[model samples]
Target: MSYRSGFITIAGRPNVGKSTLLNALMGQKIAITSPKPQTTRSRITGIINDEAYQMIFVDTPGMHEGKHLLGKTIDKLAVNSIQGVDVVLFVTDRHLGKSETKILNYFKAISTPVILVINKIDLLKSKIQTDEIILSYINAYPFKEVVPISAASVTNLDHLKEAIYKYLPEGPQYYPEEMVTDQTDNTLMAEIIREKILYHAQEEVPHSVAVVIESITPNEEYNTVDVTAIIIVERSTQKQILIGSKGEKIKKIGTAARRDINKTLDTKIHLSLWIKVKKDWRNNPNELKRYGYQDE
Candidate 1:
């Protein structure tokens, strides 16, 4: 196939720094990152513009073994995004152990060409160790390419990009050349808020929380974005934790989130944060559909 534009999905276990890697490739932070596992609850698509090619990268939630309503839904979304893509980049950390084996078992037989991306090489401390880890991945799967890099430091990513071009199917551009992402402005606002909350809270609270942008009003002085986002949770206790005593914790979250919103929207934002008991929204099929977690 001639050089063409297409989608490339990034798949890997949680906390493997997949989101961090996507931001490096795009040279901007489009997806939210957190230290907590399963920080990414939905599929995020970013557009890469270059003179020779236009590649759309899809950052997916980490893969895990579970049957819970939310886990099943998240895994399904990650798996579904890989279908019909030009290439699949499967990332894994050098510290990764058995979990890596489990994730590969699912994709080893898939038709899409899999690129084994060994990330976090900066922690390897030696070139010989990195080489050994690379060989291990090669022996495990019939990968299209074996590339090592550190997403945090943006190392060796050019080789990974070059590997992707070799397998991309020839076709027309899927997005405008000047475009960077397909995410809506409103969605971007919500994600920015969510990113702040995640960075501040980390694993102290679950990362399953979702952010919704209720309203935005543009004015000469400043734009007041009235956001009534529900911090969805599986239980009442989690709701209490998010709300905090006299709402002090959430107040901090709101303050931090507002700062990011103001920068993204180019104006002051009045963000109203609220917590609601969704009763396991992740597992509830009806609730999931309503929250835009339905099958795509």
Candidate 2:
């Protein structure tokens, strides 16, 4: 029997369903997802172990133009993750445009085989339309295999998995069989909190907010975990928006985040949130490091 195992990086533009595709592939949520652009700010690794192979998937921040220091750091993180991987899953949708040319050029410099994953085929009206979109990519690069899938609907994912497995080289498992992701509990909790803020708050609030879990205490007898976290914002007005009138908005955010945390941790959750104004923490190197956005 032959075994296959290797690292695979998923790279694409923002809001292209990169995180959604990752959740579907893992059959669980390891990365956070929201309708907002640039939802993913770090590199998340999900592992799939089966009798035949172990596929390590790296879900990276979407490659884009950086408008600020934080944005630049995230873009760099996504780009750096592509190298040194056994394969690359370049995910994109039907709305292919000139901005994608830069990404294609990046792939040209890498020796790794890239599976051009044309995601969100469900949006297309017909097979002909789908083929037309795929052709544009085909003309640009020598993709090892081009697989069209709707990551949201879990459509054609089996074929995507098959394509990945076919290209993976034989090797030993990189993680334990029971392990699904490399992210720690704190990171997941903070992300869940951030995800809720992205969903509940107004559009502008999502980009300004960053959640940092200060402490997590587990009560074995109660089968519950209590979490304390700080939500960092750039301005005092943004802080007011997050906290809301009489703390109603914060309460709503906590309720939503706690529900998801309970499911992820398989325990009762008590989440405490605090809003703090950091006055441009994104550009401050020390603050960025404190918030877990480190340069590679």
Candidate 3:
């Protein structure tokens, strides 16, 4: 029996359901998802290991054209993830907008085996139009394979998985079936808190908020865990919004995040969250380095 394992990257524009698609494929929430653009700032790994093959899928932040320090740094991270993947699943939306062309142009310079995934087919009122959208991409370039799938729904993922494996070079399994993600517990916990922030906060706040776990101490005697985190924001106005009137907003964010943390850890959690303001940290090189977004 031959086993195949290789890297596959899900790269596309923000809010294009890239992370959601990876979660669906892995059948677990290895990556966070929200309605906001760039919810995933890091390259999250979602592993799908089967008996015959183990497929490692990387979900990267949306590729946007921005030159701001933060934007450029994030863009660099996204582009760097493209290298050395066995197959690059260039995801696109059926709801092609003014920026769709720009998204397509990203692949024009790539040399990897590009498999165009036209996601969000569930939203299409007419399935017959799938051909035209597929053709639009196919006409642009000779894709290895073009497959349409609804990432949010458990629709056509078997086909997507099959299409992914078809391009993967046959090899041995990279990881055991029990492991699903590469993110550590600390990073995953921070992401869970950040996910809650994105869910409850306003549009701009999601992008500005960063959760860092200062310390995590488990206590068996008290049957609870102690966690301290600092939620950093870019501006004072955002800080005010995050704190809310007498800190109701932060309270809500804490409740939502604690429940998830408890579930992830399978224990009672005594989580303490605080907020801080760092003015224009996104553009500050020092802050960017501290935030782990710097190029090494």
| Candidate 3 worst ten-residue window by lDDT | 95-104
Residue 111 of model 1, lDDT score? 86
Candidate 1 local lDDT, 1-296, one digit each (tens): 35578799999998899999998998886787877787787898889877677899999999886467767888888878788788999998864469888777877657899998989999898989988888777777788888899999999999899999988877887787778887777777777777766766645456556666666665546545456665666678877777778987788888887787677557666777776777666667887767666445
Deviation from native of the Cα of residue 212 in model 1, angstroms: 2.1
Pairs with steric clashes in candidate 1:
69-283
Identify the runs in model 1 with alpha carbons over 4 angstroms from their true place: 1-3, 202-204, 219-224, 264-267
RMSD of each: 2.3, 1.2, 1.8
Candidate 2 deviant stretches above 4 angstroms = 220-222
Per-model lDDT: 0.79, 0.90, 0.83
Tell me the TM-score of each prediction against the true structure: 0.90, 0.97, 0.94
Ranking by TM-score: 2, 3, 1
lDDT of 3 by residue, 1-296 (tens): 68889999888888889999998997767788898888888888989878879899999988887566887888778878878889888888764555666756666677778888888888887877887788766666668988899988878889988888887888878877888888888888889999999989987888877778899898889978899999999888998898899999999999999999888757688889988898878788888777666531
Q: Pick the TM-score winner.
A: 2
